[model samples]
Target: MNAIPVDDDSLTWGVPSRRVAAFFIDSFLIMIVTLGFAFVFAFIHLMSFGLLRGPAHLVLLVGLIYLAGWMASPAMATPGQMAVGLSVRRADDLGRATLVQAIAFTGLLYLTLVAGVIWLGVALVTTRRRAIHDMLSGLVIVRAGALEPRPW
Candidate 1:
């Protein structure tokens, strides 16, 4: 699909608070799903505690992949983002982000424990309001339906 020029003036960048809320929402959903998988695994193999360890990790990994794929899809947002009225798109031209971009964004987010503080500080100070992952992936999270067509 062709990238369309977005009217910068009309674009409303998602606030940090809203973005944080979305993160928590997504995290909670992922946790519930992982726990369900763990419970099922434990039930299926009552004697094999090792089943929980391996399957739990695999479930989390699959959840992460699902999250990335959801973000990269044409919706350009996850369920959390959708609920919060946020969508992620390429910063260059407000185009939908590719799967690679979505995966990188998710991976960098997991690194927040190590580099998040620094990145958060940078995001707050930047005019574009992009977090580290967003900056690294050339993505922007904006208010859903906020993008407008630019005048020729």
Candidate 2:
């Protein structure tokens, strides 16, 4: 009697075992840096008699946050990621993403967020356990100093 072979697809990727704290830490750290840009924009608006203080300010803040998270993710990863032992990397390439690449990811992430369900799809997928924004940006959040490969 011949036996059929089986293939396990779960071994292809890994999801970091850390709890949500790392995600929050990375987000908060990026936001703090982005706030600096917000303040500058705010101050400039203030000098102009509050012309840009409301909706315009909010739009600028969101954009600044995206830019900060994308561009400085690697820099912040050295420390902020070190704090939670998590780091961000490109998914398919599995290497340090360039600043421009990161920025592009941020822009695409905004586009992906138009529908809330897309984010859910990202988190639910079997590939790397990332959010839709991550998928759109070609990025992954992984353990920083981990040595062993995950069995997925």
Candidate 3:
């Protein structure tokens, strides 16, 4: 994807609090959609095989689901994000980076979910209020169509 040129007037980072609110809504929506999609796929696979798959297969499948969402969602220039006035783009305008980079970031995100939650804390403190995954993925979530930012 070509980089959306960041002009001097563009927000680039410091997006307002409302954008953060919209991000949460988008995230919840993605969760619902992805899970629904995964379940349907899993059911079909299960029925065809007439046996339950191992946890490993399920984990791989789920990872693929997320990766596909991550890749395809942004394929539209913007995704559910743009619909709600947000965009996900690389920090350095390096295309979409790579799948391995995205997966590694996701791994760190899940690992942080284990006990200490340090990465979660990092997300809370981000300049644009990006989640750990977003930061790691080098994607900024910003208001899509608005000119001026909402009041702080």
Candidate 4:
């Protein structure tokens, strides 16, 4: 099999293991935020004497979308990606991904529940180490600063 490049000059794709670690970190962070929102909602529900079911799920969904967009913005990377020394970029220009790509990437991730096994298999075998969501959004996850010459 051909080797994947990791030199300072070439596009240094993030290692699969690191990517998985990043995923877990991001998930945990998201969960924490969701839980916080749930707590607030729960309090509100109690105040209402259980008349309201609460919008924890909706808040979580919106929070996730906001988080993804913020992370993929030109100026920043997600906290988890930063922790893992990784970042997301546009596949074509190696620049920071746009908000649209960020949203689409996050939305596509939900599909993984139904087709995630296949998606994970593809990610494992792909040359660039990108998952289905990455491909669909024309984005790539790479070592942080791997494409530093270009504007973020």
Instruction: List, in order, the clash count of every candidate structure.
Output: 0, 0, 1, 0
Per-residue error for 35 in candidate 4, Å, reads 0.9
Per-prediction TM-score: 0.80, 0.54, 0.50, 0.79
Q: List the residue pairs that clash in candidate 4.
A: none
Q: Per-model C-alpha lDDT, please? A: 0.76, 0.56, 0.53, 0.71
Cα RMSD to native, each candidate? Answer: 3.5, 7.8, 6.2, 5.6
| Candidates sorted on lDDT, descending | 1, 4, 2, 3
lDDT of 3 by residue, 34-103 (tens): 6776787688678869455553245444544464356445452224445555544555652453556555
Model 2 clash count equals 0
Off by over 4 Å in 3: 1-52, 55-60, 71-80, 115-118, 121-136, 146-152
lDDT of 4 by residue, 15-130 (tens): 67777787788889778877887888888889888888656457748545755766677655677777878777787766678888888888787677466556766777776777
* Best lDDT among the predictions, by candidate number: 1
Which residue runs of candidate 2 sit more than 4 Å off their true CA positions? 1-19, 26-80, 112-114, 147-152
Clashing pairs in 1: none
